[model samples]
Target: MLNEKKEMPLMVRQSLDQTYDVIRKKSIKKKRTFNPQVIIAIAASACLVVGLGLSNDHVMASINKWLGFDDKGVEQAVNNGMLQEDHHSVTDQGVKIAINDHFSDENKLGLSFQLAFDHPSMLKHVENVSLDYRLKNGDGQYIEEFIPDTKPLKGKNRYTSFFDYQNPLIDEKSGMVQFNTLSDSSEGTIPKLKDAVIEIESINIFDNTGKLKKINGHWNLSLSNNKKAEEMIQYKIQNVSSAIQVLKARSTPTALNIVLSLKGIDKERDEKLPSDMVIVDEAGHEYRIKGLRSVSKNNETIISANFPISSYNQHKKLELMIKGIEKIHLIKQ
Candidate 1:
């Protein structure tokens, strides 16, 4: 009888080994990793077999039922991370974006961007990202459009000229232009540039966290209230002709007397206009706009304003704008 007892214990031990083999085989076949939960389930199955101490075959059957062997296929035993499971919140993909042009004139724009994703790997596939931005008026007409991927966020990579006007250089000292080269092929025919409300959409496969992992999705963006670009060059007047005409016809016919009343300048006279900066009118006439005589206590620059100008009376639009200079204008009362 004592020998029978020893045999019974031996049978139980053999049965337990068979159960472990079954579980381990199923895990290997499914390519699944066993976590603490699976370990606990295995331990519980062992306890059930010992507590009953049934015949070896009967114990095996009981162990199978306890572990849900019939229902627990390899498919249900695997654990995948959140990203792999395809579950993420909307805010995860929505991130703040900013544009920057470290090498740009005060006028040209530099694009900047920032975004967050459900997974860090999303940042790796940024090559396919696309962004579109437009400035509009209240009527929904566009004022400007920007696409970073189609063209480099900046212009031609050329040095800025100081004295050169309209063509890109403000003066030999202060302004600059830049160009960038890209390897990506053009996606399709370029879109027309028009003034319209801002609209944005894009797709990307980024794995910012690592090269092997990637996040794939499309980005839809629309924004307004962008005040960054507008603040760069304040106080601008498009047509300075109405007043320039009267001054030219009455004054030295060739000279443009721009009575810049520095009084309107928001800053001090010394602070508004700077030394070495000359103000030129449309007549190709050049004169220093900022000097002891030019800046009055009332903050006015009465210096002679002469720049080569067109003689068309109908084109009465004399343009006077600050290029490399600090602050200046034609005084029209």
Candidate 2:
């Protein structure tokens, strides 16, 4: 194991370990191994930040750069070739709804659309506007729905922007067109989306007339990306017991998430994977990492961590070096 600095109290660390074990055990009983092959990163890790640190199975990405919608994670997903572009459109009530593009992985979907209004002034009276509809899989089942109280959490150390759009606004498209990034209203457990469709029931709007108007339309389009996504290629760790393995490591627009497993917690040095650590890529660029979650099993410990994403995929040969460890190479070059 890599030598470390800054240690959480032994008691607190053990408690966290137990929690992870329970979570991992329940996962073993409830789900099967995930094998998704998509794009981006140097490939040795993505903690699903490698659960491979997964919580949200219903994470829907909403990002549109040309129209000011911003989501770094999904945008990075596009760079990884996960997003698919669709110029398909439908005109209703003088509004042209165009499916700009989308990306999908592990039951989660992200989308961006452009609504070109025939008359730009029509939006002047729009008080509230939204798409009332559902996204269904090939089987016609809703893919995401209401958020249950028990929904998977966006891990504390995970990038907060993640798959969500930041403060998406509908009033600022700068032209006759209005951009929209949709999210979270539909859900399913269908494993993966083979062929899915988003049925737009209506373009619901509230104008200055103090009445809700539904612009019912025939706006249903195909949103199926048959291109398989990036797979979590497990990487290796050096100077650690054979038990330690890089199960997943992934980077969002500006963050890298890594999850690793250690066979047992008997050794004092192996008791924890500290946040006071550094990760170096092929170009000698350095990044510091922090622990997100640690699960300790009777015979193993699973740990997930994160660091800022910068020159990550662009530079190869990623390695993890323990802080204050006299330059020991923790991750293989």
Best by TM-score: 2
Residue-level lDDT tens digits of model 2 in 1-333: 111111010111122224233223322342222221211111111111100111111221232342232223344555666667776787776787767677654323456665656665655644334454455668655564211122332222211111222111233233233334423111111235667776665665545443455567767767856575454322344554454466655543334556666666644444333544567766887765322345568787665654544222543346776443323333423
True-vs-predicted CA distance for residue 319, candidate 1, Å: 15
In angstroms, the error of model 2 at 202 is 5.9
The lDDT for every candidate, in the order shown, is 0.24, 0.43
TM-score of each: 0.22, 0.46
In model 1, what lDDT does residue 156 have? Answer: 27
Stretches off by above 4 angstroms in model 1 are 1-113, 124-130, 136-138, 148-197, 203-333
> What number of backbone clashes does candidate 2 have, counting pairs of residues 3 or more apart or in separate chains?
25
Q: Against the true structure, candidate 1 has what lDDT?
A: 0.24
lDDT of 2: 0.43
| lDDT tens readout by residue for model 1, 1-333 | 000100000111122234233223432342222322100111111111122322222332232221221111111211110001111112213433322111111112112233333343433222122233333334444433333233332332211111100100011111111111111000111122122223333322212221222223333323232222211111234444332222221111112223343333333433433334354544655443211223235533343232212111112323354433333343322
Residue 293: error of model 1 in Å?
31
What C-alpha lDDT, on a 0 to 100 scale, does residue 79 get in candidate 2?
66
The TM-score of predicted model 1 comes to: 0.22
Error of 1 at 292 (Å): 28
